[model samples]
Target: MRIETALAAVAVFSLGLSSADAETPFKLGTFERNGRTFPGLVLEDRWVVDIAAANARLQKQHPSWKALAIPAGMKELIERYDGGLRERLHAIANEPGAATPRVDTYEVKALRVRPPVPDPETMVNAAVNYVEHGAEVAGGTQAPTPSPTMAPSVPGLWERPANDIRWTPYLFLKARSALIGAGEAIRIPPGRDKIDWECELAVIVGRRASRVSVGQAREHIFGYTLEDDVSDRGGRGDARHGSDWLVGKSHDTFAPVGPFIVPKEFVPDPQALAIRFALSGKVMQDSSTARMTHTVDELLQYASNILTLRPGDVISTGSPAGVGFTRNPPVFMKPGDVAACTIERIGTLTNPVAAGP
Candidate 1:
């Protein structure tokens, strides 16, 4: 809600890139942070360089469309429009004054990215979504007895004002203000070590939805992208896990998002996909979405049943196995480290760990 207030603080940001200068839609381009080289989609076909800017342009272009009173259904219409969304984006690529600062451009060049829908009003994370991860951490059959310490506890205990070590979703807000883009550098917090990474897919809500049925949950999702749920394992063993998690996970640049947002239409099935993480060129985690005990739809439906899902809300589906906490001596991120999370279909997100002063 303070978004309007924040944007108002800036009169204009300068970008030295020229517009296409014709009635062409901008192509979809993948971007990287800090000028790093990486793979990206160069779709000259059509796409909006910036959703907010395009909306303003659309209002000026066809007054008739305005009378139609269509909200920001551009994403939906783009999927079904004449040439489809990409095609339409290309058509208006050169629209005057509809361009955004190139500095914020999602280009292939090095630059930071944040959750497209940063500052999600509500956030939820699934627990034990990955069966194998659950098995590895809990050790089943062979170690039938539940680790008394591993049982789910009250939520928001990971890192909160108070701490409860009991296991649960242990959810907390990373503060929308703290989100940074993929390829951005993450500052290792002072007085903290044992850094950990949890690779998970994030879902963005399309509209104001509540009590959305499991069958209709897909309708609620606008798209999906990659997010690395970086953690502070040193904060473990606290009584109030949620409070601790809030602090541990809310450190600046803890949540890295984006490479390109693959809309839900592109991913008909959120399950049956593979997710992984690589740190400093070493494979740290590899698991399938199929391993999640609760599917995306299920997680959405479950969370909505409890609260209204507003547009831009985020749900971090649970992570797979191989967390640093479970290692022999435990493996945590150190200064000058590079970490990446790759989800099948969704592009991989990589970030560098810079030591704190």
Candidate 2:
């Protein structure tokens, strides 16, 4: 019963206009069951409350409250989240009894999980945002770094952002067609042998932002989710251009994202989180965001400078060192493989690998 109470407490935290009490923290995602797809509010990492159905019930119970239209999909929900909808969601989560699966709630394990945000306005991804990752994936096959030796008080390459102008984050646009959800199959294109994986921490933009500074970036952040920046090492299998950013990275099923979204309120420090990836239960890329050459704020600031960031837009902060193509023997993801990308405080995004038709 104590464990159950603790779970209820998470969704029941109060949000104040003055000096606030602890804010309620919850995850948002798109899930499917039977035949319909709906947005879900995940509580305590175990339960999923069907947003549309629960809100309807809440409104019926309290006629005094203004009725809000149910969102048709996840993207619509995110766009309307900050505007009156979030408070209604809070009401649904903070219902009288313990927060258990009720009429409109179900165990998350039972649902067919879809990408947290089905359609983002845009996906701006950073390239080589981690220093050591830059070194290892620079060119041909690489051997692992010799040791964790830092000249300072530590013995590692973990350091703060470089002061040079080179630290300005380089951003790329990813096609919306590439996105797939948790537990979905990552179809390896036929004839393209070298399939790689890059586990990254993706930032979900909250509001429409443009020209925002690093200091103001946090406010624009809606939440954080996991993105597997799956790559095709054999670029187009031809030297059409020096590099084929679109073809190499934009293949269908290349971007496996989300199980759900962890609101920024819960993630106090995005850079301090431990991000890792594993294949078929074997650890592959294990690193911390602490090693990022450019922090989330910087990337947000830079990306917003060039283009406006809309609600539900994803900015994949880039992956860490241990990529498959960087190994001496050059490991690659093949059929019958399962890749999982995990972030601290957030859940994992696992996708099964399969061959294309």
Candidate 3:
């Protein structure tokens, strides 16, 4: 069968798809081998196929294929994929004999995986984007208050439209320098005793967008990945600017991102994915993206209204109701503990906890 024929067969995609049946069925990421790093396509969730090398081989054998030049990095790939570059990727994944002996392939278990997008220009994180989470942060018992008496408590973000339309997503900028790849360590900065974890679905931008409408926001999205927005709840140890986020969210190794990026096409309904995080083998945060008080498109539209979102920027859509700082006695991450964030379609991002000076 022709490559195009096979490609069309798998082209039909939908809301929820296992990696096996979806188009491409693979994700894009960066892997380290022989002490060097390069961008590659992770296939069947086990093998890493070197895009540049594999494409060159496919070209030598199939001269009729109109494949564009392999992108030098993940960011470049995102920028060019929609413009006549995705077909070549489809051929690599769907064509039966696409993997030639000459094509470079490595067992994922044998190599080191790095952050797919090492340096996004910016990262905007949402606060209380989930109602149940808002309840937890506000000192509730993880459920909404059915009856309010004195001060008019949070009605669990007050119900959507009633909330989503009246309220804009609360966002904070996190320094890109805080990013750590999968399998790395989430270090506790010196002098901070209360460290917390925020597991979120990170939306990756594919285009340069400024003032875009909510309807057009989806067009600028590239894919989805996971990020652990590690936090330092001990404040700056003072009372000045009690609302300062930099002191709590911008420490190095605080944002643990990646494993890989599943293209938006594969994830038809980002809101349908299951999001959960565990610490030291215990499940802590568990909820679905459907609980998000504001949808991804609405968040993008609001953010683009303030600043241009360029290719490779990330938006952490917010966490659910199980953060450590708001617990009964409060549970915090300590040295030697491990944290793992897993999204259904996107892979898991695991990192160990450490104390740093």
Candidate 4:
């Protein structure tokens, strides 16, 4: 499809106001019950409105009105999301309490919170997409040394000016099975000692996209969520290749995502959000999405050109500087460390570290 036509299609599907004026009316997630998962509306910090049950109630009154299909899951909801579904959800959410049906209400503490898109078809992550992060990964500059008989030399540093660098995003794939939800334990595997944390802003794709342009990228996005891209630095490389991201990145519980997915309308400017993470009570990685070398749209555009992006596929834009491995004393997460990744507008995803079996 023509880029403009594709963009217009996205606008029609977007349930709320355009990103510029979109307020986060509500958030979406999944909660477990009796070994089954149900899509839910995050009404508040500790409460959720079960969309599946609410839709069933609505179906009884209006048999033909099936905005939220029965047995709805977050993945299915994203695929069928539109203005009508948004309105129906808003109506149910705005009803007066006590008078409203209490059967659909659930406390956050009483159930298991699953990943926003628990079964994403694929999970793509950007590596070193922040300028400072790239430089730090490459090893920062060394101070100029003084010479006994000659002038001191200038320090050597890596530099990539805007005009000199290509706008293309460098992307990599992470295992879909690596996903773990909020409050779950990120088990540190046996024999791997250097486990690090990379707090990132994750983009959830709402539609199927292939060869999409940057202008239409935002429309394809379902919403945003927080992801802690945990890495096993010790398993990063071996003799055959200098770097093996699959080994370093795709371990079980390496990708801790969610808390919930906030729709794009709520996030006016993805680039302006403050992204940070704290280990235990100590702030470790702290930065802003504004520092990213490639914007969300640019990354999506680049990825679409290479492969088709399906609904529920996640694209983690990238992490900022302050990763533990790059520090002077190189810090890493240990068993019992609680890592919490927080992004502005979105929410925090906290997971504890445990030794793997």
lDDT of 1 by residue, 1-357 (tens): 233222222211112223322222222223334554322222232222443345445656555432222224333332333223332343334333444334223434433344454446666666556766776667552212334555343342222122333233323455564577766777788878877888999887766678776789887776777778777767646576343656667677777776556656457588978888999989989988887666787677767767788766778898888888888788888888999899876677888998863
> What's the TM-score of every candidate structure?
0.66, 0.84, 0.87, 0.84
lDDT of 4 by residue, 225-298 (tens): 98999998996445686878887898999999998999776687999999888999799878899988878987
Task: Give lDDT tens digits, candidate 3, residues 119-215.
Answer: 7888999988998888888776563433323233224322233322334468899998898899988888877879999999999999998988779
Candidate 3 clashes between residue pairs 3 or more apart in a chain or in different chains: none
User: Candidate 4: where are CA atoms >4 Å away?
Assistant: 1-24, 58-68, 98-101, 141-164
Q: Which candidate would rank higher by lDDT, 3 or 4?
A: 3
List pairs with backbone clashes in candidate 4.
Answer: none
TM-score, candidate number 3: 0.87
Give the runs in model 3 whose Cα sits over 4 Å from its true position. Answer: 1-24, 97-103, 141-166
Backbone N/Cα/C clashes per model: 46, 2, 0, 0
Of 1 and 2, the candidate ahead on lDDT is 2
Worst 10 residues of 3 by lDDT: 150-159
lDDT of each: 0.60, 0.81, 0.81, 0.79
lDDT (0-100) at residue 288 of candidate 3? 95
Residue 236 Cα positional deviation in candidate 3, in Å, after optimal superposition? 1.5
